[model samples]
Target: MVEHQDVSAPARLRVGIDVGGTFTDAVAIDAATLQLVGQAKTPTSHDHPDGVAHGIVTALHQLLDQVGRSARDVVFLAHGTTQATNALLEGDVAPVGLIGIGTGASAVFTKRLAGLRTIEIAPGKHLPVEYAHLRDPHDAAAIGGVLDRFDAAGIRSVVVSEPFSVDVAEGEDLVADAARSRGFLVTAGHEISSLYGLSKRTRTAVLNAVILPRMFATADLVADSIARAGITAPLMVMRCDGGVMSLDEMRRRPLLTVLSGPAAGVAGALMQEKVTDGVFLETGGTSTDISVIRNGRVAVQYTEFGGSSTFLSALDVRAVGVGGGSMVRADLGARSVVGVGPRSAHIAGLPYACFASADDLTGARLSTVAPVPGDPSDYLVLDGPGGRFALTLTCAANALGLVGEQDYARADQEVAALALTPVAEALGLSVRDAAQRVLATGTEPVLDVVRALIKDYRLPEDQVVLVGGGGGAAAVTPFAGHVGELEWRIADHAEVISPIGVALALIREQVERVIPGATDEQILGVRREAEQAVIAQGADPHEVSVDVTVDPQSHTVRAVASGATELRTQDRSSRLSDDDLHRLAARSLRVPPEEAQVLASTAAHRVYGARRRRPWWRLGGGPEHPVRVLDLDGVVRFASPDARVEQGTVGDGTAMLPRAVADLTSYGDGGSRAPALRLLVGPRISDLSGVLDESSLIALARSELEGRDRREDLVAVLERRA
Candidate 1:
């Protein structure tokens, strides 16, 4: 019997629940120690709209029962579902009314987007002609007229887009105010993206608006289910970017949850395997998702919605319709060929040969082909009764002994072999060869995606590892050898890895602005906004770090704020006090505590303003110079020796901060190797891996920080790495 951890730290319980097409898997872990407590899987409820929620609740209850705990013990609960992805794929979305501002808008507002109605407000670029001409009267009337039309057309959601809105969004804002007054949920184009592509931004806004109603309903159902189970912890939903957001944030921007399930699986592989770089293969019952992890970070790309690209950042994952439950068939067309699916057995409503009943096999011809000693699905042929059915990848792996005995017990190998025999005969091949052929064919699509990611990222072939996850992981292992010399490993709890990823995911918020020639203060304002956004979503305020990048060329600045989920049991006494703040400022400026004045105080930290006196010798032998200094305009976080700091230094002269911070933090208290340093540069925050050594980076940072003018321009923090 497995020993269970004590429930004394009930509030430390973190539960991850993933809802897949076939099953709802749940895992409970001790968040503080990062130890697995218990795990359970329940068949996904597909009977009604509330099926996913029901399945999640069922799985959660089972997990708690196994560990002899209660729902109240869970301090954190995260969910990753296919509900949004399926809704988008199946054309199940709410109708949205789009109010376009500017001339030639009608040309781009075609029938390309499903369930969208368009109305042009006025003609102009930044501000519509009516808004620019009359400020309020004409523009207000125009917006009201559009809203009236949308209401008449039964539109409850609205997407407002205008040309050059990223630069001047007043026109979009005016339309949003009018639409909201008319009781419509509004998605503004500028709010979704700060890029210049109006068409893509408009499409993205429409997608976000249309998915709101359904996603809000789903969120409510999940919240209600958790409430019913006596768990009060904030519920988090995984995002397409491989991080998680609070329920409120998800409801506001459901578009981020698209493809979240696959993203979560990649996150789980990265965390559980502890690998910095690799290709993650998440094979589910219906599909396989492939993603790349480069230099300890999951690769991210703009989200593509229904074949149309959007400006939202999402995990760079490629999914193919081939997995454990994929159907095996012989296409006897112009050219006879053995095919593995883009379709699944569940969709066909046919049981796998291993799970088929004896009565279901009555008319099937049975032949003993290549019987593996104890495996049932291999070496047998059943070509009679119940129409032609064959073993799926899951069954094939079981029959060949590639799957562990524990997993094999879930299906009947005899039944699998019986169903596969006929397909082998049709192809004029032995059962063993046919089984091998089926596995290889299924792996081709996945391998192709893997090869593409490796080639595109120019990943080191020798360092890349293939990580298998999801229920069909066993099916992927058989072909790993054929993919070349890269190492391969399956994640622990591979079947339920997606949910585990969701549970372990950090809270992240990103803010992008197109401010041309922005001042240092304005850049810091945006970074602080991003940090607060993440904190509002349940992240610890002190643990949050903001990464900012400015492109003088495009005049775009993007900030990403991220932090670990705050625990209720965390020590609060260590928070910096007012006295501590004064002392820090004095120490930084080489002055007395009385000389520093508190300029501002936030909930978590304080900012002090001070003046340092420079002697005549330091100022070229003149009189003493009193230089005004912001001193230390930074948050006073609890000092954690193990904390990983992410410092964003701007200004043309501050280019060396990345290298300096990396070198300074590379060693621990006793000079032992501490946490690894990951550096990202450029407006897109491109990884600077292999480009800069520790000493080089340190020298650069020192050079940048040495100048007195650049001191207050850097925003730095010490927090745990996500």
Candidate 2:
């Protein structure tokens, strides 16, 4: 139980709930003081993991009681969970069938093989019925075949996809209707991606379909739990994009919540620590994820999901298979110690309690050196707060060949030192360097691993903020001190961090228009395009704002379309058009064009200004004048006969014209044009010299003077020839 105090005259309270696979953590924060008052961690019940809410409410009630405050004082509730990620990853999710129209030629079908079932509608077929136009009209047969397949697999829901379906969803509607007739819950693709890209759009739709059931289940449980706890305050879920949204909306777009848990830690970490411009390393059971935070925001990189190279800028988090609890063995043939991971052992096999039996060879070595004789077989290892299972040092040591009196004869420190060298070498580090890096960091085994690797690589272990959720966290602490300024922090509950990350992430909705060429005008059009979209999304037209960012050298422009929402239904947009090229030309070369073609379009959106939009114009000139021209007058006689001309008669003058220039006398009866070029008055040689650079003048002098000498020499040579 935790205690809290209400110190404000008018009090405000907030609760942050992070739901994970292993445990659910609840932190009650005083909105007025921004101080944490209540915190709880409860073992997660996977079967009805939904039951974890009871523990959360119990903890909150305990805090409220201690503070002598009613539950009504709680004004804001923020939540993060991992239900959606697990549903997708463990294949313990809804059975969704995908109806991909306009995607018959797309690779989404191939990609779908890994997650859900997808059927591409026959191309050239219209809505209501693709077979409507078929001469044979075998629509019934086609429908029956599709339904039969769905029935065999027991699919509960269906997601539909079609090209440009947001605007022309009729085809997708018909497909959904046909699937619905077969008793499948249908989600239209047009309802998902009103944007672009048959493949990416379809993939987004498919992922939504696969995760919707889980999202709906979690949303319902959470809402019910909140109401049951006598809390009327709204419950908000964190999106993958790091924004909050109403649970209702999150259910519809659950894919956005895939990174909710990690995002929350990223958010919580950013809030608690002064970690700027560094990477956040989150180690868990299955993998170690690394993400960078720059300027206090998670920096996202655009890369392909999985193996397919679809472009998107997402938080740069890389999950390496190496984590604590990985298997260690000696490759006798190679005469090296190798730790192999990227896969995890069943938690039941190596419970943390039997440190020796935990299947960690390192743990076994430590136990042997300590010579602590506890009942090895009866060790129960329980994880989370419950501490459930059994483990033994012999299990870990025997597996790694550390046994009997011989191994036990070594001191714990000596054994650790002996193992450290090879481990460092395995990780490509020297013993001392590994120790330094490990000591610099805070987590036990992780820092030890970091140290080993650092030593192996002969690198300095820089102190960093470490975030991990695992049994190995304690063991990794000693070595973490080696790095300078390393602040070691672990998640309140570590095991399910990634799953929680998935829940709190935002949904990315992008819209693109294919406007040809880049130009200043087209750039304006792109912004208008984004604004119109925000308005269409039910935003107050006046509240919408369009901002543009440009990289002049690369001739790139990013336009951001955003709007404020009380409920957080923020829409973000990006447009990549060549229209901005005109601006670049004007800014870079002082020459701007009026119109342009769009080379590309890319945009991402959340509730606020999270996405980018820009335009680049490739072609088109100004409306007032498509071309410009100037006329040059004669050098010798200016409205005068050659005999009356003087060296000082002309004057220096220049003019701007709108179009191609022709000789003033050639176009019509000899008349003056609106604009003409004028020259300076001076001796012929002096006037010519003024306009030319030094090199030109030198060449002119050489040519004239040398030619005279050459002429005289030529004459002499001619006389000699004669």
Candidate 3:
């Protein structure tokens, strides 16, 4: 165990820990001065799963020594890692226990296994699946039985997903209690989400579960590393949802942390400039990340797992896999530099002889050699596609005697100097500036290649800020020059930026309640339960508030329960316990099986709730119980030929619509009755056709109101109205 001094600095110090595949990097900063106080890099050990933990300890100890401070002096620690990502990509997830309740509850579990994984506990099963279709007492009993079976399997957690829980979470809570009593963990659907779309929510749950184990592992490493460093400071991790939580809270929902790396860079960059709107680019050995920040926040694109196109959101970012060590190859006929990569050279060590042959460029370029000699495919090989293509084209041109030897030699040097230029241009950079950028950055052979393209294509030379990282930053720095007047900046820890970036997340959880379209009293009853649940998460019950907005036509009700904690930092003594935090998070994020039933009940109630009042037309005897409503050109014409169509008439030199349209203003007072659907056929000839399919009817009515002859403007009026 390494020990840190108890010395203190004048400014607050925030630490960033980056766990990479090859090394663990740590950067400590004095927040007030914005000065870096310490930096350490330690080799990663892959064979031992806890290698990152040990590396972190080593790095912290080294950093402490350099900064002359003890762990207790640091105010906050932020870290990032790839453990959760690796676990999901490798499919090492446990079999999840699913509980679904509703008419179609079973379908959710059945679908999980098709593209994902889930073990279902249906209404007939012994255990109460977190989700269930419990219509009555018997349904609850069946769920209890399923919980028993899950207990036998020692299943640690359960997910309850029901379609309409946004209205009623009590049913889910009841079922969850029964399962928990049987020793199973329960996650209720309403607690997990309020958004519609059962499939998307379920997928999100599975992804979270898949990443949980790795997240736990990473958290454990952080804890251990802290202990080893003689640090008593509380460790906190950031969430994708834009908040921070103690380490334990983060482990339960790992998906929230997967994108934390890029998010942190955004946060850091924003903080550095005190302005967030701009297109920021971070280039490294393995990939290039371009993110746009708008209105002091990074835009978010809810990208589907492994999908290409991104939906525009608050933040818009594009990542390309073109970087240093990208393969360069030549297609002699096209006379172009065809670079191919998103792949990279292994960061394990330095380059070897075999890599020499693989890089297609005639000049010597830097590369990493594989530790074990075998198939090149097994190694992260940089394709020489772009370099070779650029070289071939230039060589062919020189051979044809189109240029002098001095010029050819100069172009050859320029080709190597401009390696990344060709690829960057392909990504979005202009041809001429791209090559010039290569020339300005350095005289590397790759830069020369990029320069050749600039001269040939006349690309722009606008100055822009550039950030480079990974194993190849040193190689590309020379060629990625300052665009115009903008200066380029690199992340403090280049190779480990991804891991460090992950440290910028917080723990997040959300729950929704289904409010049935019931009487106002019943709706209020359901909302209270949701408010109670929200308060359990360290919120003051008094601070909780409910938002209600209803749509009577759709028989739908939207209610939001929200509360906020005081803006106080965590208490060192009561920092969250790992087990307890996970339990709370899992509970908050899992959808209950009773969701659909709740939604149905809420929907049903919404319709039934409005029965206290009758529509004006239905008030007396409801058309003598047998009147047929005829669909007259999209108008519901009643059989009573003597019925009067009510329309508000505005008598003026220039008649316009009455201040309020009839549908909107025809209601009776005291909420006693609904307004009648009335249309006033005017004296105009077009009015004889009655309500002309809403669109045309409005046109005719407006035309008559404006004193325009309906015969002359009917078609154009209808088209414009539509």
Candidate 4:
């Protein structure tokens, strides 16, 4: 979903809404300044006939009122919903009738997929599926007979699947068209994925079919309500991979919105925080969802639902059961704190002790009792004027001044100390020590995840920053960063980061092909297809950039394209000046302003480098050269310890390709590998980092430069292989 956002400030406002299990949040951002101008929250209306859609509408209206802007002033509107994911978890889904088409071997393959008959969407609830097949896929009479049986059995949705549908989906399409004509919600396998995996593709499509009716109702309800508000801007929906897709696309692939809640937070980090490479931690009351953003894009992978592996690509988010409201577990006998939480104050129906009045904690005593039945009775609670209040991680952080005044989770320090004073006395340590110990224990689990991600992503050690978002972000990230000794900060409008992500997200589409021994032309064809796909969905074609990656083992060619919906800025004064770029690059490199000198420049970007001087104390660390690639807006898009930069025309780059790749390529016990490279032209950055084979790399390079004028600006940054 991360097509690079234009640095130019646009016009008007954009509204974003996020529907959570408990609350629906909406925020308005100034399109020209990207500033969060107004925000509102309303309790989720689950009991209403309209479901969460009603809450979203209410929040959006409240936000508009606060911002004093009419609906027409908004250029975009979108929301990240958890309804589909929650529906599967709660087993609130319609029955599916699968109409598989094929003959002989394909028919047997579809028949053997009996697992679809009883999928455990919840612990005790299962997804009901009825399977029916036809030899003549185009026979409307045969399809009607199958539908008659399904209708009698109370099935409301249908899935059409066939073998080799990726090659030609006519059979599946014919079945789908017949089903739709019969008023049954239809899902076609090839429409879900163009890959050759029949089983996975069918399963994914089946899951989509189950949620089709409910999601369709919500999308239609919202679209109608938005149109009634006089807003003609497209109503987009957040996808699980950090992009915003049109409402029509959502109606077709509602399953794509699964897990978009987490993706929305990281999308905010990518576009709003301008995070090129880092770990983003979004903490709520119960747990913290940790995800990584590399090279300005969110890391995504296929996700699993109810033990079923699907081709649903979503943000790779890992959750830890620890957050601000996490209750502290202690052992008075051992006089040591055991852990932070797997339970939170909200779940226990208790208010945070840090939010208590100082007078309420006066003469307060700590009593150990389990908040729920059949549990350990060592959780601490304060019994005083407040009767019973939970002592949680938020209280501990506030006590130690770890939660800043400006932070959303911040509370009165005096009240916080009073809440933790009992723990301090029980552990026979100072209140400060108690607070620190509690934080260290609480954040340890999250710290483990952070360390693993940093190493796994090969993030630049010196440049990797830890960004915190969500309401409880201050309760965890600050202390976690302190324990890990890394740079950290809460995001702007941290409480509403997810909605902000939804508002600022770009239009994105990814087209993947399984082409074995693919030629350069084939790769380029995929790239063009992806680009055209996003544009067809409302992206500005001229603003689009495509990244093509080929995997030899799977012979999978994936081209991801993204583009801004529109650009409204044209003034040259908004661009960064040379001095401004130098200061920013120098600060990012942790060197003097004078040391970070420009190494290469394109019309859209500049590569800055700083000399490395390992003192006499350090050996084997010399001869290192670090570089930072900065866009015209002063955002550092790429950072590395060693790299080579070159600027030229298309022809010049083609001629120097051999030297460019050879200079940074490495050789050792393993065979030599090509360097990671990127091409920076006017307002576009083509990522060639994922390509390893030189021939493939050159072919891709030629494809990118094919239509460009010979004398156009081109700059390449090649990272040295380690």
In terms of lDDT, which candidate is strongest?
A: 4
What lDDT, from 0 to 1, does candidate 4 have?
0.87
Q: Between the candidate structures 1 and 3, which one is better when assessed by lDDT?
A: 1
- Candidate lDDT scores, in order, read 0.65, 0.42, 0.42, 0.87
What tens-digit string does per-residue lDDT give for candidate 1 at 444-561? 7788788899999877565577888877887775465454556787777787788888888878887877777676566666777887899888888655655566665677667777
Evaluate model 2: give its TM-score: 0.51
* Best candidate, TM-score: 4
TM-score per prediction, in order, is 0.70, 0.51, 0.52, 0.93
Task: Return the lDDT, model 4, position 301.
Answer: 94
Rank all candidate structures by their lDDT, best first, as comma-separated numbers: 4, 1, 3, 2
* Tens-digit per-residue lDDT, 102-135, candidate 3: 5456455534423433322222222112332344
Clashes of each: 19, 101, 106, 0
| True-structure Cα RMSD, model 4 | 4.1
Candidate 1, 97: how far from true, in Å? Answer: 2.0
Q: Which ten-residue region of model 3 has the weakest summed lDDT?
A: 601-610
Please give the lDDT score for candidate 2.
0.42
Per-residue alpha-carbon lDDT of candidate 2 for residues 1-722, written as tens digits (9 for 90 to 100): 74333356545566677777767666665554444555556666555556655555655566567555677887767677677666555555565665544334443443343332323222321111111111111255655566567667766666766556655677777767777787665667666544456666655666666667667776787788889888886576765544455666676677666655556656554433324334455655445555555423464443343334222334555555544443333333343433333223343254423232223333322111111233122112223233332222222322222222332111243433443444455446665554343332223334444444334433323323454433333222212332324545554434333323322222222334333334545445555665565555443444444433333334333443444222222112222233343343222222334332112111110000011122234222222111110101101111100001111111101110111111111222442222122111111111111111222222222222221222121100000000
Regions of candidate 2 where Cα sits further than 4 Å from its true position: 1-10, 49-69, 102-154, 166-170, 173-185, 284-287, 301-314, 321-722
